[model samples]
Target: MIQLQSSAMQDTQLVSNMMYFYSNSARSSNGRQSWILLLPDLITQSRQQTRVAVLATSMLLLAIQSREERIFVESLGYYCQALISIRRQLPLVTDPQNPDFLPLTCVAIVLSFFEALCGTLFNGYYQHVQGAVVLLQIQGPRNCALVPYHSLFYAVRNHAICASLMTGKISPLAGEPWLTIPFSLSKKSSSDLVNDILLAMPRYLSALNADETASETSRMSREDIVQDLMNHLQNLAGIWSQISQHEHPIAESTQPTIPQSVELTQRYTYDNPYHAKVIANYRTAHLLAFSLLSIILPCHDWDVAPFLDDSASILSAAGYLEECDIGCAYFQMVFPLRLVAQHSPCATRRRVAIDMLKRWCGEKPVRGLANSALEAIYRGQCVIPQSPVYRNVYPDMSTEHSKACCERPVPKPFSYTAKGQWIKLDGMDTYITGDTKAQRAVLWVYDIFGFSSQILRGADILAHSSKEPILVIIPDWFRGSTAELSWVPPVTEEQQQKLGTFIQTKASAAIVVPHVRTFAKCVKAVYPRIQRLGIFGFCWGGKLVSLACQGDALFDVAAQTSPARVDPEEAKHVTVPMALLVSGDEDAGLVARYAENIRAETHVEMFPSQIHGWMSARGDLNRLVVWNEYQRGYQVIVQFFDKYL
Candidate 1:
């Protein structure tokens, strides 16, 4: 029995060495050194059972990143046994006066890391974070020493804040006694200052979330708290900027360093990965602060230009970090990067953010946080029922019903004329109307109905009304799958299912946005005379127009009539002038909120007498009131283009 115990102890020591080496080398060298160096002492001083638990947890983490599947499964089994043992000892560890309390606290942190590495659900990580919080509270600030515990405190604090932001739940750690822990700024690095700002974010967000439920007096107080936090973050950012500037002068930093040959597997050998991480973290802090401020302030009241500029800076830093193999060094960056992806409104920047998440997932697949971040991106891109047009059209319907409406076809009342030629552009059949020689162009993105006579006629009306000769190009963004106009609504369960499937597969913003971008580029290249371009879409197409207006300057003006799937979050990125024409029967409040959120000049016209799909429905053309509204709405579009384009 003594010899067996000795052999097991030898194995544990070997595993500890391997885990520490991996943590320092594979994860991060500089940032993780303190934690890695203290692990041995932490393990030695721990109770026998607690020591076994910590070692098992550490080995489990290493096994997760290991290339061997059998090793991973065996480690998981051992960790499970350790967890059972730890659970039985929880009562003793929970006591603040117990000798094993701090050791157990450190072990809980390692367990939280296990949860993080496995990419357990958001709640899973939060539970472990709460466990750590309890331990830290028991340890208290007076007993908390700065060296070994500092890194753990910061790590737990950051995890709590990030999980809170991602899940929209206030972290338990963000509250009173925890926040009172002194984070000394004097000896702190720039990264620490940025973390301080991040640690305060959950409190700010929690206040903002609570303001809606609070009484007027309480609301004002919460708003004041939010504003103060914002100011504090701004000051921290300023201090970080000064420190970084002094530490990394422009001349010295800008001078190109000689590129060293690095193997793909040995990329982490580079020296400046930490420097790049610091820079990225600093920029991300500013991005988060500005983003929160934008959320708190009214859309028209705040200038998004700073947010835009900061997003660009973060993207640049992310690129450098990627090259340095430190892209996934900080999990805290995932939340900020997710925000950038969701809110930037610039398609290029959003794509970069998404790609960064993808790259991070590739690099750190064991850390399932990137997968959650990707899901957030997917959610942002997917059409939801909260859109103004969607809510108005299907006020009582579920998200599935709103999606069904996009696939339901509108009638084609008129005939395709010779003036409007069907030509193939970029290997896709396109319906072209208006003057081909015009200096100005309007890309009329049609809804799920594809190219119909009614839509082409509307294009002709727009071209005729333009102050300058305008070439209206209608690209079949839907390829050829367009629903035929029907006098009766399709009510069959099978039909509804088909429509829903079609919307999910074909009519998604993800699928349509990229095609629209490609089609816009093709149209511009086809007609070099088109110096100014405007984009207009109806219903499903309106969502595409909104996306087109997001970041690319290809379109000078954008107009959406009865636009569906215009995510309010994505809508805030619009910088170009916009015109929103809606039927009076639609959700006026939703539209008004959307109009208010747009940053550029916006004109919202409501034809209260008209119904949804009046602009594109040939059946609606017969109704005098609907026809008049369509004419008026078209006139609004022409005037908007004339003014802006």
Candidate 2:
């Protein structure tokens, strides 16, 4: 210590901390260090990009430990440098035969880990994993049996599966080749087996989800999906039963002292952390299978009540694993613990699971991201209460009834090269057009069919207004989870239910309005020239726009076209000038009631001939009438914003 250089000391501490945290995790030991623990060796021997990624990962770990903004900044700097270097070198490593292929793969995995730990955008983590998945596919699974390649594949596979879960897409690794090939040379571990089963969940869930909205010609029969899911359910249930038969005697001497706030249940403690993990995983999978069954069939025969009993057991095992000598084992339990907290029927058990998560988050920096994601899901699930118009006037309208009542036109593909380009605003991909230097701006929130050709054209028109050219921005509010065209016409009963669910969950006003405000604030801050901001929405977005315009809103003025869930009572609190272009399909009485309550310079025009989504997602602009109406709608908005903003 007498001659210790501060920089050297810091680097040493960073590596030491990373090793301590990762190596201590209950991982499948293959007579070698885990890929994460190989960082120190990788730093010395790897290429510049791989070396930079390892350094970035270590710096981020230190940043997490110290909670220092400067260290975090340093980590980000290294991360971007690594990313640029990797992209430049990627083409050279396209051949798996190249010596740099393994290093390139390693770089991608490291970058993915960094994003997962602390990415600002939701898609950052798994999006990087997707890139790595492509690379792994190019390399082929058979080559992954090699020493360093095996370790990298073993590490990236979990993230690949997690990415699939996050995106609702089937993982490439879900194929039989991937599942069997890597382990062809060696036996699969307990965790590997558990992961193999877990991998099927996303594929099956994705199939079922797609089938619900698919046309009869394309859709799988519900019976076939159910039968396949039932097979997996049986397998998981069998695994759970077999694991339950084994007795794991707890060695109190080896058990670390768990904090008093977190109490472990008396459901068989284990000396082996791997055993505890296996039990927890299988139980979680079994519970998930049951949940899937209920969603698939929703009949009393597939009730999840019987599986509800396992919630307590799952948490008990998770708690035990978290308190074990290998403290980082809890990282593996993040998904299972979250599932328990989310789906567990027992209130007290859910509380315990949440409490444990909170404690873990406080102690470990990585838990923050996992917890944040879980919290976002919780927020998304909260359905904003619908207005009386939707609740009483004409509730539970079938898809056919809705289309008929609204004069909904079948959406057709139209080719229009957008005049404006896409750029990120507030970490969201946004469509920006018109005068970038304008002092006034309009924030356009599109209908449920996100970023449709019609919506983009509308934004371009608003931006390029002949007399009043101003900036028009349309943020990708849905992040690609837009309502499918199939769901709109909803030929099948399942599609109808899916549409309702999408409205209640994905496009919920509670979830979107806050983001709208944030984006508005960001726009203002980023463009200091923007002295005033106006917001407008169509269909689903109209409801959010309406909500965003109330109570000392960020927007100077607001406009809505065929707003869903129109509320007269909430309109009474409007603090800005508002305009409504009511569609023929909408309840005129409700619009009048809302307009009457608005305490602002308000304009209400009735588009009696047009459908609900005419100016945005549903309009057939090729037709003369639809084209005329669409142009007029944009003109009205430009005129309104010109007056107010």
Candidate 3:
């Protein structure tokens, strides 16, 4: 009997060690503390059965730690025994109304963790997650107020939210009762606020997907839903701001606090590491919230500047976390950091975020989550919620520009008030704006939807915004073929083939280059005072700008927005200073690859929320979001010209 007691104590100690290893070392720690706290109760209730489960869990941890085939098999045997025992007790323990339901759920959660570690072919972990969700729904919030129950409830809720996002499925927990649960005022912390925001994410995603499928008549109501979500986000941001001002109240007052600093070295030796971790967590929440807001709000309504600012804060916080040797805290930040990496216009910040992700991957195997982060960085695309009206106007492009010029929205015509007169140049009608007597000149190239009022308005804004006196000229580059054409939905293969044929024959580089040169010479002849020259192109015109830069020295500088057919071979010959502004949805990998080959000083700026042709094709001029991006792109062009011309 004494020997039996000694053996039982040894097994319990082993169980304790395994619990510590998993809780402290695993990539995910949800519900781990709660399980640890319930260990004694579990042993007391069913010592033999609980010992088998604990032994299985310990062996699973050892298998992961050792990566040995023999140990993994041994762990599987112990797991099978525990699972059988649990199945026998399921009738009583799985009943949500029973007092033991929460404890049993915790046991199931831990077993699921072991199953995931064991490399189960089927998604065994998700089964456990779904089971927990059903139990929580049956138990309700009132029943979740007990010792281990509250923590388990939060852990399960959080896991469901994250799993739903990762799997691209609407969360089952995203129901009215779950979202409407009022926050406990006394228990409020930054973490709790973050949880509240995260719980709302699935509803937001559902609304966005719903808006995509809504009928035209109901689109306006859907827009209101998006607006309501935005207001909620704004309120959350306000609460976060208030919370960040104070040190985390839950942190012990006796612990020394380190002043927030950006220096990596100083962070490494900080007296109070938890204080820095709290700040990092707050920043992570802000980054994710703003990133989601940027997606949900219309491009014309969202502000990219503040998003950029928040991204910087996240990067700084991540660096602080890394240097403080609290990289586990930094691991929780990968998703938001990856969002910033894929969408931020700033190259340096994006690179830093990517590097951080790579570093994390190198540090530990994180079940391919890190790999997905790298993939998102390279792809540089995310779904943005849009109204059905907008969807009807601009459908998804089927192929790259090689097949056809990518489908773009037909911008509503605006009044072109810029002072300019049409002049015949190289057998084409040209509209000139700005000072005709100015020594410098800018040639504007139109896209497939040639010489629209929207393009003219953009030209007028450019002409007026430039600091120097210059003549702005718009050439009818499409030769009137595209004047009456607009994007019709259900774009077919035959239509794309015909469009590609037309581009190859009528608007190819062989045909457009000489005409552009003739027009340039004609402009110089008409205005002898013109010495410095620049070319600005949109869409199809962007290709012309590239051709002109490569084939001739007629222009000192060139700028293009949403350029098509910019092959890397052609980019190599670019000899003039060039500025390229592209949409976030464009192939960033292709652009970055081609930019490297360009011989001249090249600046490529990507607008995170803008679609192709956004600079000149947004139908709504009054939208702050669209107008802001338009103004920002225009200023970039103007600055590039002012510096080079």
Best by lDDT: 2
Candidate 2's TM-score reads: 0.56
Each prediction's whole-model lDDT (CA): 0.62, 0.70, 0.61
Scored by lDDT, model 1 comes in at 0.62
- What's each prediction's TM-score? 0.55, 0.56, 0.50
Encode model 3's per-residue lDDT on 272-296: one tens digit a residue: 4344444444554454555555555
**Candidate 1 error regions (>4 Å):** 1-33, 41-66, 146-148, 172-189, 211-230, 246-271, 299-303, 322-328, 381-645
RMSD of each: 13.0, 12.7, 15.4
Give the TM-score (vs. native) of candidate 3: 0.50
Order of the predicted models by TM-score, top scorer first: 2, 1, 3
Q: For candidate 2, lDDT tens digit of each residue in 278-379? A: 777777667766676666654445443445556756776766766663534544566666666655555455557777777666666445446553553343
As for TM-score, the candidate ahead, 2 or 3, is 2
In model 2, which regions exceed 4 Å deviation? 1-13, 29-33, 211-219, 245-268, 302-306, 324-331, 358-362, 381-645
Clashing pairs in 1: 584-608
RMSD of 2: 12.7
lDDT of 1 by residue, 458-496 (tens): 888887778888888887776778654441244553454
Q: Per-residue error at 618 for model 2, in Å?
A: 25
